[model samples]
Target: MATNFKIERRSAGGVRVLALDGYLDAHTAPLFESAIQEEAQAGNRRIAVDCTKLSYISSAGLGVFMSFIEELREAGGDIKLASIAPKVYQVFDVLGFPALFDMLETVEEAVAKFAEGPREG
Candidate 1:
């Protein structure tokens, strides 16, 4: 069995912060999908995925976001990523994901950029 991951959500300065721990690969991506779906269903749209402890991510995990980005955006909400590991960042960079999403280097930075907050340079 794959290792279980942890998903923690809390309201941070008006945005929903989702902190993820462990790997986000084929078997574990569904757990993440369900979490995001549940949150969306509840009308909690402003999402931030804090991946400080996420060690790995497969293509299927990437697809979860690719498939939901539009839905989230249409609802006047957005997804932000923070604390990406270098390995994970390489995967995203190789796939041109830096152009596809708002990625931050730290959790503090993510909290500062709430949905309606000022853009960071």
Candidate 2:
């Protein structure tokens, strides 16, 4: 089946949150990328993607994150992942992106992290 996905962005406690729901595969990866770009364009530096509702994701989806990481970081912002499903976490772990993206267990935690300041790298 074709991957059906939708992205929603919101701001809470000075953090931008992207609620991603549905499969994130080759077909839907571009949508996710676009959402990230839109958020960045809006001056949303700190970003968290809520993946609790995300069902599936592929390498292409992961690539979108990779593509945006540098830009976000350069903007004094970062991208974080929260509420990720186990399967998706496994994928991130395998690719070592979980560490790179600051994967968190909850949206609240992500928000707090964002408030803590950017990663010191």
Best by TM-score: 2
lDDT of 1 by residue, 24-98 (tens): 888888988998899899998788899999888889889888877789887877788999999989988999988
lDDT of 2: 0.88
lDDT values, one for every candidate: 0.84, 0.88
Clashes of each: 0, 0
Off by over 4 Å in 1: 115-121
Would you list the clashing residue pairs of candidate 2? none
Off by over 4 Å in 2: 1-3
Residues 16-71 of candidate 2 have per-residue lDDT tens digits of 89999998989999889888888889888789889999999899999999999999
Q: CA shift at 9, candidate 2, in angstroms?
A: 1.9
- TM-scores of all candidate predictions against the true structure: 0.89, 0.93
